[model samples]
Target chain A: MALDGRIEQAVVAALALSKGADAPPRLQAALDHAVFPGGARIRPTILLSVATACGDDRPGLADASAAALELIHCASLVHDDLPCFDDADTRRGKASVHRAFGEPLAVLAGDSLIVLAFEVLAQAAGDHPRRAVDLMRILAQRTGMPGGICAGQGWESEAVIDLAAYHRAKTGALFIAATQMGAVAAGQDAEPWEELGARIGSAFQVADDLKDALLTPEEMGKPAGQDAAHQRPSAVAEMGVAGAVSHLKDILGGAIASIPSCPGEAKLAAMVRAYAEKMTPVHLSPVRG
Target chain B: MALDGRIEQAVVAALALSKGADAPPRLQAALDHAVFPGGARIRPTILLSVATACGDDRPGLADASAAALELIHCASLVHDDLPCFDDADTRRGKASVHRAFGEPLAVLAGDSLIVLAFEVLAQAAGDHPRRAVDLMRILAQRTGMPGGICAGQGWESEAVIDLAAYHRAKTGALFIAATQMGAVAAGQDAEPWEELGARIGSAFQVADDLKDALLTPEEMGKPAGQDAAHQRPSAVAEMGVAGAVSHLKDILGGAIASIPSCPGEAKLAAMVRAYAEKMTPVHLSPVRG
Candidate 1:
């Protein structure tokens, strides 16, 4: 199966237990609502691509890793859109989890998903114990504080922010998780995959800033100009749109170049190049220009 | 060392990564605030006790399981005190996470702690890979949906609530985890330990309801009559304070009787008896009466 199909299947399996007859219907529905109709599925896709590049000897573990990374990503989005944070009303072109389900269920949904992500990895640990352990550790590291996305969010509350560290953690952590976990899932060294993931994450953040600064709410399907409204630090706010766009191109180039010595290095580069195109808008596409 | 000391040491180690200089200062503070000055440390104590009863060959894994369970409990309390949920201003005799650090930081702190729980388990995997995986899976199951605490919270939102399931999930889930995970940490079967945990959890919930209904805010160190205020399901409300206290006695009796045969059965029973005495109020003490 393709990466997309594998991701969906794995996510379905991970959520099956929660959707049972005895489960609370609304929370189960909220779980479904948060995950389904996913946008891009980029993190899991990168995870699988990296795993494939590293031989993917344990396909089951790789699929679980992919699903786990995406679940964490989804979980973050749910929490990010809560009233205390962005108060975003829309996500993936639909009502945000909090908007659709109310604040309590939204909070519970995000928490459940985070727990479920780790649970999925542990469930898949039957035969691939070491790899599963590695996947959980890496995912937890990227999901939590000090160096994870939670730390990234925490940076926002700081009186003075270090833009670089903030972006590295808030934006780059999970992308790094995707690559590192992917490599670990396939029995490879996780360290070598970090650069590629970081670069991809940095490029995406820049691209996101460009979209928020340049696009309308209709175009983005959620609130736009949020960074400006919230007085958040942004690449586009610091660097002009043109400069941010250029920076994105540079980062994507580095990402492709940093594929490490994998069996399918060329294939992974091609995949990154494809994503680079998708990430760069057509009007200012580096490839088009 | 005793279970209490082991639990504290393990929790300290788990939070070390998040307490570094680089972490968001407020978030680090919030993490410490939430976990420190713990209420009873009852859950972890229960977990370690069960592990010891099962012949704990791996103290490290037992410690991790204990800490992980406590972290999950702390995370839940942090969220429960959020404005959207219980809107609780205090917990554990002090300002709740939200009150102390504000809403955003509280949310992030809770998320960070939840991730930290799984990470603690994975980090302890080492040579105890199987036990580690079991621990993570069990912890996640109790933390998340269907039968977990999240499911317990979700039952509140439903129009038609299953009272038994609600109590089983919200209060009983982690208690079950404490016993099941304790057994798993000691390389024992988890199923047989469920009844004891369930009875203990049920007793705690009743005792909590009794406190909420009877005690003043000064006595409880937090809000009182909350269950009645929120119109939440309460054993005291349903069964009356007298009947609820009696039910507490019955559950404690069952809890002690339900202990599975183990190397330290007598010791475990004694510990349960101690908790039973603690759980029952002076006016309602079954032993005194």
Candidate 2:
């Protein structure tokens, strides 16, 4: 199967475990609502791409890891949209999980997804126990505190913020997990894959900053100019749109070059380049010029 | 070391990972506040006790498993107390995580603890990969959907509640995890331990219902009459005071009889008996009689 197909199948299979007949219908429905019609699916795609590049000897583990990473991302969005957080009314062109399912079910759904992510990994661990354990570690570290998305969010509540740490954790953490977990899933050293993910993550963050600064809410699907509205530090805010665009190109270019020497390094490079093109299309190329 | 000491040490060590210097200070404080001076530490204590009864060969894995179970329990309490859920002002006799650190941090702290629970198990998985995988599976199944604590909470949002499923998923889920995970950590079959956990969990639920109905908020150290206020179904609502007490006795007695044949069967039975005594003390006997 292609990456998207495989990703969808993995997600479906994993969610089936949570959608048993006995499950409370609303919570189960909330899980579906949070996940399906996913936005971009960039993280899981990156995970599978890396896994494939590294041989993907254990396809089941790789697929589960990819799905697990994406589930964490989705779970974060659910919590992020709660009334206490961003209070986002819509996401991915639809009502946010909390908006659609009510706050209590949304919270349970997010919590359920987090647990289900590990369950997915654990279920696939039977044949390749070590790889599964590694995936869980990476997922946990990237999803939780100190240097994870949760920590990234936690930084916002602090009086003093570390901009670099904030961006690295808020977005870079999962991308790093994507690359490292993908490599580990395919029996490769996770350390060698970190730089590639970090560069890609930086590129994506810059692109997001540019889009938020330049695009309207209609163009972005969800609310736009949220960075300025919330007074959040952003690449565009720190270094003008033109500068952010230039920096994005630099990061994406570095991402392609950072691919560790693997059996399919060329293929992975091409994939990253393709993503870069999508993130920074021809229309915006002349904006910096 | 004693069960309490081991449980505390394991929790501290596991949390230390998330409490690194780089962590957001308030978030770190929230994590500590959510866990410290814990109520009875009963879940972890039960886990350690079961592990002991089954010959805790892998002491590290058992300790980590015990802590992980308790963290899940604590994480549930944090979310359950959220304004979106219980809208509670206090938990464990202190301002709830949300009340103390605000809603966003409370959400993150709960999330961080959940990830940390899986990380705890993963960190200790190196030596006993199979056992660790088993532990993870059990934890996930008991903590997430259809049969977990999250599912238990999900039931509350439904129009028609299945009381058995609600009770099973709610209080019974973690108790089951404690017993089954304890057995798995000790390299025993988890299936055999389910009955003991279910009965014990049932007993605890009945005891809780009785306390909520009979005790003052001052005695309970938190709000009372919540079940009546919310109009939620409970053993007390169904069976009244005397009937609920009799039912509690039946369940606890059955729990003792349900202990799976193990090396430390006698000791395990004694521990359950001690817990039952504490749960149903002398003062309450006359009210039911």
What Cα-based lDDT does every candidate model obtain? 0.89, 0.90
Best by DockQ: 2
TM-score (chain A only) for the predictions, listed in order = 0.94, 0.96
**After superposition, candidate 2 runs with Cα above 4 Å error:** A286-289, B286-289
Residues B58-167 of candidate 1 have per-residue lDDT tens digits of 98999889989999999999998999989998897899999989999999988999999998998998898888998998899888988899999898888999888888
What's the true lDDT of residue B15 in model 2?
Answer: 86
lDDT of 2 by residue, B43-156 (tens): 888898999999999999999998899899999999999987788898888899999999999999999999999999999997788888889999999999978999999999
Candidate 1 ranges beyond 4 A from true positions:
A216-218, A222-232, A285-289, B285-289
Quality of candidate 1's docking, in CAPRI categories? high
What is model 1's C-alpha RMSD?
Answer: 2.2
Tens digits of per-residue lDDT, candidate 1, A127-234, equal 878778988999998989788999999998889887777888998999999999989999998898899999999998988888888777877776789889987778
Q: After best superposition, candidate 1 residue B43: deviation in angstroms?
A: 0.3
**Each prediction's DockQ against the real complex:** 0.82, 0.85
